[model samples]
Target: MTSIIQTQELSYEAAIKMCVAVTQHAHQLGVSVGVVVVTPAGVELASVRMNNAPLHALSIARKKAYTAASFKIPSFNWQERLKHKPDTMSALLREENFTYLGGGIPIIVEGKLFGSIGVSGATEAQDIECAEHAITEQLNSL
Candidate 1:
Protein backbone atom coordinates (compact mmCIF):
# COMPACT_ATOMS: atom_id res chain seq x y z
CA MET A 1 0.00 0.00 0.00
CA THR A 2 1.21 3.48 -0.84
CA SER A 3 1.51 5.99 1.94
CA ILE A 4 0.92 8.92 -0.37
CA ILE A 5 -1.32 9.72 -3.28
CA GLN A 6 -1.20 12.41 -5.90
CA THR A 7 -4.22 14.55 -6.58
CA GLN A 8 -5.14 17.61 -8.56
CA GLU A 9 -6.54 20.31 -6.34
CA LEU A 10 -8.96 23.05 -7.27
CA SER A 11 -7.54 26.51 -6.58
CA TYR A 12 -9.49 29.30 -4.94
CA GLU A 13 -8.73 31.54 -7.91
CA ALA A 14 -10.19 29.01 -10.29
CA ALA A 15 -13.19 28.49 -8.10
CA ILE A 16 -13.78 32.22 -7.97
CA LYS A 17 -13.60 32.39 -11.74
CA MET A 18 -16.21 29.67 -12.01
CA CYS A 19 -18.52 31.58 -9.67
CA VAL A 20 -18.07 34.69 -11.76
CA ALA A 21 -18.86 32.77 -14.89
CA VAL A 22 -21.99 31.41 -13.31
CA THR A 23 -23.01 34.89 -12.27
CA GLN A 24 -22.53 36.24 -15.80
CA HIS A 25 -24.62 33.45 -17.22
CA ALA A 26 -27.33 34.07 -14.66
CA HIS A 27 -27.35 37.70 -15.66
CA GLN A 28 -27.81 36.72 -19.25
CA LEU A 29 -30.82 34.66 -18.27
CA GLY A 30 -32.21 37.50 -16.19
CA VAL A 31 -32.11 35.48 -13.00
CA SER A 32 -30.30 35.45 -9.70
CA VAL A 33 -28.46 32.38 -8.45
CA GLY A 34 -26.18 30.84 -5.92
CA VAL A 35 -23.02 29.09 -7.01
CA VAL A 36 -20.59 26.91 -5.09
CA VAL A 37 -17.29 25.17 -5.77
CA VAL A 38 -16.05 22.29 -3.70
CA THR A 39 -13.14 19.91 -3.65
CA PRO A 40 -13.45 16.25 -4.51
CA ALA A 41 -13.66 15.57 -0.81
CA GLY A 42 -16.61 17.96 -0.61
CA VAL A 43 -14.72 20.80 1.02
CA GLU A 44 -16.05 24.15 0.00
CA LEU A 45 -13.60 26.53 -1.72
CA ALA A 46 -15.78 29.41 -2.77
CA SER A 47 -19.43 30.37 -2.99
CA VAL A 48 -21.62 33.23 -4.09
CA ARG A 49 -25.28 34.10 -3.76
CA MET A 50 -26.32 36.81 -6.12
CA ASN A 51 -28.45 39.72 -4.99
CA ASN A 52 -32.13 38.73 -4.86
CA ALA A 53 -31.30 35.02 -4.95
CA PRO A 54 -33.31 33.23 -2.33
CA LEU A 55 -31.54 32.57 0.97
CA HIS A 56 -32.34 28.92 0.47
CA ALA A 57 -30.32 28.91 -2.72
CA LEU A 58 -27.00 29.12 -0.88
CA SER A 59 -27.58 25.95 1.09
CA ILE A 60 -28.96 24.15 -1.94
CA ALA A 61 -25.97 25.17 -4.00
CA ARG A 62 -23.58 23.87 -1.38
CA LYS A 63 -25.36 20.55 -1.20
CA LYS A 64 -25.42 20.28 -4.96
CA ALA A 65 -21.64 20.67 -5.08
CA TYR A 66 -21.18 18.21 -2.27
CA THR A 67 -23.44 15.68 -3.97
CA ALA A 68 -21.57 15.92 -7.27
CA ALA A 69 -18.18 15.60 -5.65
CA SER A 70 -19.21 12.77 -3.37
CA PHE A 71 -20.75 10.70 -6.14
CA LYS A 72 -18.36 11.73 -8.92
CA ILE A 73 -21.39 12.41 -11.12
CA PRO A 74 -23.74 15.24 -11.94
CA SER A 75 -26.13 15.69 -9.01
CA PHE A 76 -29.08 15.58 -11.40
CA ASN A 77 -28.18 12.04 -12.43
CA TRP A 78 -29.41 10.85 -9.06
CA GLN A 79 -32.97 11.43 -10.18
CA GLU A 80 -32.92 8.67 -12.76
CA ARG A 81 -30.36 6.55 -10.97
CA LEU A 82 -32.42 6.29 -7.84
CA LYS A 83 -35.75 5.62 -9.53
CA HIS A 84 -35.35 1.85 -9.27
CA LYS A 85 -33.22 1.76 -6.14
CA PRO A 86 -35.60 2.64 -3.40
CA ASP A 87 -33.34 1.19 -0.76
CA THR A 88 -30.30 3.01 -2.04
CA MET A 89 -32.30 6.18 -2.48
CA SER A 90 -33.58 6.02 1.04
CA ALA A 91 -30.09 5.71 2.46
CA LEU A 92 -28.62 8.31 0.17
CA LEU A 93 -31.36 10.83 0.73
CA ARG A 94 -30.52 10.89 4.40
CA GLU A 95 -26.85 11.50 3.84
CA GLU A 96 -25.90 15.01 4.87
CA ASN A 97 -25.64 17.50 2.01
CA PHE A 98 -26.79 15.06 -0.63
CA THR A 99 -29.21 16.31 -3.25
CA TYR A 100 -30.79 15.17 -6.51
CA LEU A 101 -31.14 18.57 -8.07
CA GLY A 102 -30.13 19.30 -11.66
CA GLY A 103 -27.42 21.85 -11.16
CA GLY A 104 -24.24 20.13 -10.05
CA ILE A 105 -21.29 18.82 -12.05
CA PRO A 106 -17.88 17.50 -11.25
CA ILE A 107 -14.97 19.54 -12.42
CA ILE A 108 -12.98 17.16 -14.55
CA VAL A 109 -9.32 17.85 -14.98
CA GLU A 110 -7.49 15.68 -17.50
CA GLY A 111 -9.93 12.83 -16.92
CA LYS A 112 -9.74 13.26 -13.14
CA LEU A 113 -12.12 14.85 -10.67
CA PHE A 114 -10.51 18.06 -9.49
CA GLY A 115 -13.60 19.34 -7.74
CA SER A 116 -17.21 20.23 -8.43
CA ILE A 117 -19.48 23.17 -9.18
CA GLY A 118 -23.12 23.77 -8.32
CA VAL A 119 -25.66 26.43 -9.23
CA SER A 120 -29.12 27.11 -7.86
CA GLY A 121 -31.93 29.72 -7.52
CA ALA A 122 -33.26 29.38 -11.05
CA THR A 123 -35.19 26.56 -12.60
CA GLU A 124 -33.30 23.28 -12.56
CA ALA A 125 -32.75 23.47 -16.30
CA GLN A 126 -31.38 26.98 -16.10
CA ASP A 127 -29.13 26.10 -13.20
CA ILE A 128 -27.74 23.11 -15.08
CA GLU A 129 -27.19 25.19 -18.18
CA CYS A 130 -25.14 27.70 -16.23
CA ALA A 131 -22.99 25.06 -14.61
CA GLU A 132 -22.22 23.32 -17.89
CA HIS A 133 -21.54 26.54 -19.73
CA ALA A 134 -19.13 27.73 -17.04
CA ILE A 135 -17.12 24.53 -17.26
CA THR A 136 -16.91 24.65 -21.04
CA GLU A 137 -16.17 28.33 -21.41
CA GLN A 138 -14.22 29.33 -18.31
CA LEU A 139 -12.52 26.17 -17.08
CA ASN A 140 -10.69 25.35 -20.28
CA SER A 141 -7.40 26.54 -18.90
CA LEU A 142 -7.55 24.43 -15.78
Candidate 2:
Protein backbone atom coordinates (compact mmCIF):
# COMPACT_ATOMS: atom_id res chain seq x y z
CA MET A 1 0.00 0.00 0.00
CA THR A 2 1.30 3.43 -0.91
CA SER A 3 0.62 5.76 1.93
CA ILE A 4 -0.23 9.26 0.86
CA ILE A 5 0.66 12.36 2.80
CA GLN A 6 -2.38 14.27 3.92
CA THR A 7 -2.75 17.92 3.06
CA GLN A 8 -5.11 20.02 5.11
CA GLU A 9 -7.82 22.32 3.86
CA LEU A 10 -7.56 26.10 4.15
CA SER A 11 -6.89 27.49 7.59
CA TYR A 12 -8.61 30.41 9.25
CA GLU A 13 -5.31 32.24 9.34
CA ALA A 14 -4.81 31.81 5.61
CA ALA A 15 -8.30 33.05 4.91
CA ILE A 16 -7.78 36.08 7.12
CA LYS A 17 -4.48 36.92 5.49
CA MET A 18 -5.95 36.54 2.04
CA CYS A 19 -8.89 38.72 3.01
CA VAL A 20 -6.66 41.47 4.34
CA ALA A 21 -4.50 41.42 1.23
CA VAL A 22 -7.54 41.44 -1.04
CA THR A 23 -9.24 44.25 0.82
CA GLN A 24 -6.05 46.29 0.93
CA HIS A 25 -5.50 45.79 -2.77
CA ALA A 26 -9.02 46.86 -3.53
CA HIS A 27 -8.63 49.96 -1.40
CA GLN A 28 -5.35 50.83 -3.08
CA LEU A 29 -7.08 50.54 -6.43
CA GLY A 30 -9.99 52.67 -5.25
CA VAL A 31 -12.44 49.81 -5.64
CA SER A 32 -14.92 49.00 -2.93
CA VAL A 33 -15.33 45.26 -3.24
CA GLY A 34 -16.88 42.32 -1.46
CA VAL A 35 -14.72 39.25 -1.12
CA VAL A 36 -15.46 35.64 -0.19
CA VAL A 37 -13.24 32.71 0.55
CA VAL A 38 -14.75 29.26 0.39
CA THR A 39 -13.72 25.70 0.96
CA PRO A 40 -13.83 23.04 -1.74
CA ALA A 41 -17.35 22.09 -0.73
CA GLY A 42 -18.51 25.71 -1.02
CA VAL A 43 -18.50 26.57 2.65
CA GLU A 44 -17.46 30.13 3.35
CA LEU A 45 -14.30 30.50 5.38
CA ALA A 46 -14.18 34.26 5.46
CA SER A 47 -15.97 37.17 3.85
CA VAL A 48 -15.66 40.95 3.80
CA ARG A 49 -17.50 43.81 2.17
CA MET A 50 -15.87 47.16 2.01
CA ASN A 51 -17.72 50.30 3.03
CA ASN A 52 -19.79 51.75 0.16
CA ALA A 53 -19.77 48.43 -1.68
CA PRO A 54 -22.93 47.45 -3.45
CA LEU A 55 -25.47 45.37 -1.57
CA HIS A 56 -25.45 42.69 -4.23
CA ALA A 57 -21.69 42.41 -4.18
CA LEU A 58 -21.71 40.05 -1.19
CA SER A 59 -24.01 37.59 -2.85
CA ILE A 60 -22.18 37.96 -6.14
CA ALA A 61 -18.82 37.28 -4.54
CA ARG A 62 -20.15 34.24 -2.69
CA LYS A 63 -21.68 32.84 -5.86
CA LYS A 64 -18.43 33.41 -7.68
CA ALA A 65 -16.51 31.43 -5.07
CA TYR A 66 -19.08 28.64 -5.04
CA THR A 67 -19.02 28.45 -8.82
CA ALA A 68 -15.24 28.25 -8.99
CA ALA A 69 -14.90 25.72 -6.18
CA SER A 70 -17.70 23.50 -7.45
CA PHE A 71 -16.88 23.71 -11.15
CA LYS A 72 -13.09 23.85 -10.84
CA ILE A 73 -13.04 26.54 -13.52
CA PRO A 74 -12.79 30.28 -13.45
CA SER A 75 -16.14 32.06 -13.27
CA PHE A 76 -15.26 34.20 -16.29
CA ASN A 77 -15.10 31.06 -18.42
CA TRP A 78 -18.70 30.35 -17.53
CA GLN A 79 -19.57 33.91 -18.46
CA GLU A 80 -17.91 33.49 -21.83
CA ARG A 81 -19.64 30.19 -22.45
CA LEU A 82 -22.95 31.67 -21.45
CA LYS A 83 -22.47 34.40 -24.03
CA HIS A 84 -21.74 31.92 -26.83
CA LYS A 85 -23.95 29.00 -25.84
CA PRO A 86 -27.23 30.09 -24.41
CA ASP A 87 -28.76 26.64 -24.13
CA THR A 88 -25.79 25.14 -22.36
CA MET A 89 -25.49 28.27 -20.34
CA SER A 90 -29.09 28.00 -19.29
CA ALA A 91 -28.52 24.46 -18.12
CA LEU A 92 -25.47 25.52 -16.18
CA LEU A 93 -27.26 28.51 -14.79
CA ARG A 94 -29.89 26.18 -13.48
CA GLU A 95 -27.22 24.33 -11.56
CA GLU A 96 -27.64 25.26 -7.93
CA ASN A 97 -25.51 28.22 -6.87
CA PHE A 98 -23.33 28.53 -9.97
CA THR A 99 -22.45 31.97 -11.27
CA TYR A 100 -21.16 33.36 -14.55
CA LEU A 101 -18.89 36.27 -13.85
CA GLY A 102 -15.35 37.30 -13.18
CA GLY A 103 -13.43 37.40 -9.86
CA GLY A 104 -13.42 33.73 -8.84
CA ILE A 105 -10.13 31.88 -8.52
CA PRO A 106 -9.22 28.43 -7.25
CA ILE A 107 -6.62 28.13 -4.51
CA ILE A 108 -4.21 25.35 -5.29
CA VAL A 109 -1.77 24.06 -2.72
CA GLU A 110 0.72 21.27 -3.23
CA GLY A 111 -0.89 20.55 -6.61
CA LYS A 112 -4.29 20.02 -5.01
CA LEU A 113 -7.24 22.38 -4.99
CA PHE A 114 -7.96 23.66 -1.51
CA GLY A 115 -10.80 26.03 -2.24
CA SER A 116 -11.53 29.33 -3.99
CA ILE A 117 -11.56 33.10 -3.44
CA GLY A 118 -13.81 35.61 -5.14
CA VAL A 119 -14.20 39.39 -5.33
CA SER A 120 -16.96 41.62 -6.67
CA GLY A 121 -18.16 45.26 -6.82
CA ALA A 122 -15.71 46.71 -9.33
CA THR A 123 -15.36 46.19 -13.04
CA GLU A 124 -14.93 42.54 -13.93
CA ALA A 125 -11.29 43.12 -14.80
CA GLN A 126 -10.57 44.90 -11.56
CA ASP A 127 -12.35 42.26 -9.55
CA ILE A 128 -10.24 39.61 -11.15
CA GLU A 129 -7.09 41.60 -10.57
CA CYS A 130 -7.86 41.91 -6.86
CA ALA A 131 -8.53 38.21 -6.50
CA GLU A 132 -5.38 37.32 -8.41
CA HIS A 133 -3.27 39.65 -6.35
CA ALA A 134 -4.68 38.16 -3.15
CA ILE A 135 -3.65 34.69 -4.18
CA THR A 136 -0.27 35.69 -5.55
CA GLU A 137 0.64 37.91 -2.65
CA GLN A 138 -1.03 36.38 0.38
CA LEU A 139 -1.96 32.78 -0.30
CA ASN A 140 1.46 32.07 -1.74
CA SER A 141 3.09 33.31 1.39
CA LEU A 142 1.15 30.76 3.39
Candidate 3:
Protein backbone atom coordinates (compact mmCIF):
# COMPACT_ATOMS: atom_id res chain seq x y z
CA MET A 1 0.00 0.00 0.00
CA THR A 2 1.09 3.51 -0.75
CA SER A 3 0.16 6.71 1.00
CA ILE A 4 0.05 10.20 -0.39
CA ILE A 5 0.56 13.49 1.36
CA GLN A 6 -1.96 16.07 0.28
CA THR A 7 -0.57 19.55 0.52
CA GLN A 8 -2.81 22.00 2.30
CA GLU A 9 -3.38 25.19 0.43
CA LEU A 10 -4.42 28.60 1.68
CA SER A 11 -5.62 30.92 -1.00
CA TYR A 12 -4.81 34.62 -0.83
CA GLU A 13 -8.48 35.43 -0.39
CA ALA A 14 -8.74 33.14 2.59
CA ALA A 15 -5.74 34.79 4.16
CA ILE A 16 -7.31 38.17 3.62
CA LYS A 17 -10.55 36.97 5.12
CA MET A 18 -8.71 35.83 8.21
CA CYS A 19 -7.01 39.18 8.49
CA VAL A 20 -10.30 41.03 8.17
CA ALA A 21 -11.93 38.88 10.81
CA VAL A 22 -9.08 39.50 13.21
CA THR A 23 -9.08 43.20 12.51
CA GLN A 24 -12.81 43.43 13.04
CA HIS A 25 -12.53 41.73 16.40
CA ALA A 26 -9.69 44.02 17.38
CA HIS A 27 -11.70 47.02 16.35
CA GLN A 28 -14.61 45.89 18.48
CA LEU A 29 -12.23 45.86 21.41
CA GLY A 30 -11.15 49.43 20.65
CA VAL A 31 -7.70 48.22 19.73
CA SER A 32 -6.19 49.64 16.60
CA VAL A 33 -3.85 47.22 14.88
CA GLY A 34 -1.88 46.43 11.78
CA VAL A 35 -2.23 43.02 10.18
CA VAL A 36 -0.07 41.09 7.75
CA VAL A 37 -0.79 37.79 6.08
CA VAL A 38 2.04 35.82 4.52
CA THR A 39 2.38 32.63 2.60
CA PRO A 40 4.35 29.68 3.82
CA ALA A 41 7.27 30.92 1.77
CA GLY A 42 7.16 34.18 3.72
CA VAL A 43 5.67 36.24 0.95
CA GLU A 44 3.13 38.80 2.04
CA LEU A 45 -0.35 38.19 0.68
CA ALA A 46 -2.32 41.01 2.26
CA SER A 47 -1.66 43.75 4.80
CA VAL A 48 -3.75 46.37 6.51
CA ARG A 49 -3.31 48.99 9.19
CA MET A 50 -6.20 50.34 11.19
CA ASN A 51 -6.94 54.05 11.08
CA ASN A 52 -4.58 56.09 13.25
CA ALA A 53 -2.26 53.11 13.62
CA PRO A 54 1.42 53.95 13.85
CA LEU A 55 3.31 54.16 10.61
CA HIS A 56 5.98 51.80 11.88
CA ALA A 57 3.33 49.25 12.75
CA LEU A 58 3.02 48.12 9.15
CA SER A 59 6.69 47.24 8.98
CA ILE A 60 6.60 45.57 12.37
CA ALA A 61 3.54 43.55 11.41
CA ARG A 62 5.12 42.36 8.19
CA LYS A 63 8.35 41.47 9.96
CA LYS A 64 6.52 39.50 12.59
CA ALA A 65 4.53 37.58 10.01
CA TYR A 66 7.63 36.90 7.98
CA THR A 67 9.50 35.72 11.02
CA ALA A 68 6.74 33.31 11.96
CA ALA A 69 6.31 32.00 8.42
CA SER A 70 10.04 31.52 8.07
CA PHE A 71 10.58 29.94 11.48
CA LYS A 72 7.24 28.11 11.81
CA ILE A 73 6.96 29.33 15.40
CA PRO A 74 5.06 32.03 17.22
CA SER A 75 6.80 35.36 17.71
CA PHE A 76 6.43 35.17 21.48
CA ASN A 77 8.39 31.93 21.57
CA TRP A 78 10.98 33.52 19.38
CA GLN A 79 11.28 36.30 21.94
CA GLU A 80 11.76 33.75 24.71
CA ARG A 81 14.37 31.96 22.68
CA LEU A 82 16.16 35.24 22.25
CA LYS A 83 15.89 35.95 25.94
CA HIS A 84 17.81 32.73 26.61
CA LYS A 85 20.46 33.50 24.02
CA PRO A 86 21.31 37.14 23.71
CA ASP A 87 24.12 36.58 21.22
CA THR A 88 21.98 34.46 18.96
CA MET A 89 19.20 36.99 19.28
CA SER A 90 21.53 39.78 18.17
CA ALA A 91 22.59 37.67 15.23
CA LEU A 92 18.99 37.03 14.21
CA LEU A 93 18.35 40.77 14.27
CA ARG A 94 20.96 41.17 11.57
CA GLU A 95 18.80 39.17 9.21
CA GLU A 96 16.28 41.15 7.21
CA ASN A 97 12.59 40.92 8.27
CA PHE A 98 13.05 39.18 11.58
CA THR A 99 10.99 40.45 14.52
CA TYR A 100 10.67 38.93 17.97
CA LEU A 101 7.30 40.38 18.73
CA GLY A 102 4.10 39.07 20.28
CA GLY A 103 1.90 39.66 17.25
CA GLY A 104 3.37 37.07 14.90
CA ILE A 105 1.96 33.57 14.74
CA PRO A 106 1.95 30.77 12.22
CA ILE A 107 -1.35 29.55 10.77
CA ILE A 108 -1.41 25.79 11.08
CA VAL A 109 -4.27 23.69 9.75
CA GLU A 110 -4.77 19.94 9.90
CA GLY A 111 -1.32 19.73 11.49
CA LYS A 112 0.09 21.27 8.34
CA LEU A 113 1.80 24.62 8.24
CA PHE A 114 -0.20 26.89 5.97
CA GLY A 115 1.19 30.38 6.45
CA SER A 116 1.28 33.12 9.09
CA ILE A 117 -0.55 36.24 10.29
CA GLY A 118 0.82 39.14 12.31
CA VAL A 119 -0.96 41.87 14.23
CA SER A 120 0.60 44.95 15.79
CA GLY A 121 -0.04 48.49 17.08
CA ALA A 122 -2.16 47.18 19.93
CA THR A 123 -1.19 45.89 23.35
CA GLU A 124 0.84 42.69 23.12
CA ALA A 125 -1.94 40.73 24.73
CA GLN A 126 -4.51 42.18 22.38
CA ASP A 127 -2.34 41.57 19.38
CA ILE A 128 -1.76 37.97 20.33
CA GLU A 129 -5.44 37.59 21.06
CA CYS A 130 -6.36 38.82 17.60
CA ALA A 131 -3.87 36.56 15.94
CA GLU A 132 -5.11 33.60 17.94
CA HIS A 133 -8.72 34.36 17.16
CA ALA A 134 -8.02 34.47 13.47
CA ILE A 135 -5.87 31.38 13.38
CA THR A 136 -7.90 29.29 15.77
CA GLU A 137 -11.41 30.31 14.90
CA GLN A 138 -11.79 31.98 11.53
CA LEU A 139 -8.95 30.48 9.52
CA ASN A 140 -9.24 27.05 11.00
CA SER A 141 -12.97 27.04 10.73
CA LEU A 142 -12.80 26.99 6.99
Each model's lDDT: 0.93, 0.87, 0.85
Task: Give Cα distance to truth, residue 9, candidate 1, Å.
Answer: 1.3
Query: What would the per-residue lDDT of candidate 2 be over residues 1-142, giving only the tens digit for each residue?
Result: 7699664568877887888888999999998999999998888999999999999998999999999898878899877667878899889878767888899988876778888999999999999999999889865575
- Top candidate on lDDT is 1
Candidate 1 vs candidate 3, TM-score winner: 1
Q: How many pairs in model 1 have backbone atoms within 3 A of each other, for residues 3 or more apart or on separate chains, i.e. clashes?
A: 0
Model 3, runs deviating above 4 Å: 1-8
* lDDT head-to-head 2 vs 3, winner: 2
Model 1 has an lDDT value of 0.93
Instruction: Quote the positional error of residue 142 for candidate 2 in Å.
Output: 3.0
lDDT of 2: 0.87
Tens digits of per-residue lDDT for model 1, 38-80: 9999999999999999999989999999999988999999999
Q: Give the TM-score of candidate 1.
A: 0.95
Can you tell me which runs of candidate 2 are displaced by over 4 Å?
1-7
* CA shift of 46, model 2, Å: 0.2
With a 3 Å backbone cut-off (N, CA, C), the pairs that clash in candidate 3 are: none
